[model samples]
Target: MTETITRTTGSADVRGLSRWTAAVILPIGPAAVALLRYFLPYDTVDDSSTMTSKVMAEPGRMSLVLWLGFIALLTLVPAAYSVGRMTRRRAPLLTAIAMFLVVPGYLALPWLAGTDQLLWSGTEAGLDANTITRLAETPHPTVAVAGVFFVLGHVLGTILLGMAMWRSKVVARWAAVAVIVSQPIHFVAAVIIPNHTLDLIGWGLQAVGFAVVGWAILRLRNDDWDLPAVA
Candidate 1:
């Protein structure tokens, strides 16, 4: 008879992917937020504007690109690893579905922001223009173009995220709920109000999401405990 092995390998694998996702993906939102907030200001077109398209263009675009890339990569990563970790345990396909949704949602962020960025690129000042100039020059982004994703992705994604975290308890349950609630707030603003309305709320909510996930990854880093082997 062959010796059978039942270890936390499945959990371990998902855990690894989760850690990787947390390290790379979680930081993306905050990184973009920080970069824009600190370096790029609100895009002034004044001659006094020091930053140029060449400067902010690369960093800003790269942030969106990399963030989306990570999100896409993670969609495949988590779904594959989750099938095994969650098999016969709980969540079943929901785990994979939730994991996969992250990609589309991420892609949506750049798509929505693309118009503004492209237009800004045409000018000497990309993201360093004065608020009034930027508002007057740029078209007030369309509904279908950028609004939908901003509403659905963040809102639904947050709900699924809360469920995922709650189901797995990878991070504390309440922390997941905290992230979940922000989605509606983001979605409502995107759907009805102006984008600027969500500036602080969106950033603050995302900050919480990152903090919780990052903390979970750090705690699990040294863990090698196997679920099956425990008993």
Candidate 2:
């Protein structure tokens, strides 16, 4: 009986730790990604050749930015999962749908990162900007599909998740609204206007939104965060 109790306690402890860790990293991922966008060395023109030239000009800084983005992508997975878990009880279907979109969307990071890596390699090989741009622009069917998934998944999924959180009342209404509006603003700032400052603000809203969620999670009892193991 003692052994059984100990085993159950250990399981509960592990579960609690997992949820707490997720809570801690939730805000961090979005914040890091937001900073990555703000500090990106690429030009605002959306021209591959211009971007390549800028990256080549500051290879070290660009590399660091890329790595920061990679790490942010890694962290976002758990952050999404934790949000889903928090809102699931009240909005199970929405959480499910959001996770379905978000998981693949964030997972497609490698496909996006491949372009940056390709540019870096071309620069290192002393290729001309136009040549590198040509290679980067060469479309692959698989990459094209992944790009679609990445865009739809992150943008739509985040909005859905925010709606779920709002319905569930897991986070403050303002925070939920922030999450819902963040991606659309980011899209406009990144694509429509291409203003890095606006881009930062867009993603910064998401970071703030998630930060509030993290605080809510931190306030929960371990049993509430993750159910205690049955004995």
Q: What is the C-alpha lDDT of each candidate?
A: 0.48, 0.85
Residue pairs clashing, model 2:
none
TM-score of 1: 0.52
TM-score of 2: 0.90
Models 1 onward score TM values of 0.52, 0.90
List, residue by residue over 40-150, the lDDT tens digit for candidate 1. 333323232333333343555535544444444344233323222422135545555655554455556555455434434545343444552444345455536555654
Error of 1 at 167 (Å): 2.7
